[model samples]
Target: MSFLLNEIAPDDPMWNKRGALYAPSGEGPTVWAADDIYTVKAASAQTKGNIGFIEATVPAGGGPVPHAHTDEYETFYVL
Candidate 1:
């Protein structure tokens, strides 16, 4: 298995600005496309463009077509 590690310097100011982010279950902006659902749990604006949190629920054989995000990266976790 491969692992990615991220480390921040001890003096980094980012550490001082860290805070909790909570989104109670079933609470967020939801969008529906056909039979699929996309929820914006935490938007980019809320995270200062650092991240765009999304939770998606798609029916069998439903999802985005093969694509690439040129500007930034995207990661997905299957539930």
Candidate 2:
């Protein structure tokens, strides 16, 4: 089965001190930019050290290179 555009979403209750939306900053360690690419999303801080996540808009044929991870597992959910 498939889902519509509005059917998929991820909300973090820990977004703010009072359930507010989390804002991405322009100048922070979470912000990365290069080669016409820009992304500011949560990876670990939002998961309380349990998981890492990010809602990124990856360009065509544009993604991160392969790397190794011995202590963590990765999952990709392309909604």
Q: What is the lDDT of residue 4 in candidate 2?
A: 19
Give the residue spans of candidate 2 off by over 4 A.
1-30, 35-43
Show the lowest summed lDDT stretch of 10 residues, model 2.
1-10
Q: Cα deviation of 1 in candidate 1 (Å)?
A: 30
Q: Which candidate has the highest TM-score of all?
A: 1
CA shift of 72, model 2, Å:
0.6
Q: Model 1, which residues run further than 4 Å from truth?
A: 1-18
Clashes in predicted model 2: 0
Candidate 1 per-residue lDDT, tens place, 14-58, comes to 332356456558866677765778776665555666986778898
Clashing pairs in 1: none
Clashing pairs in 2: none
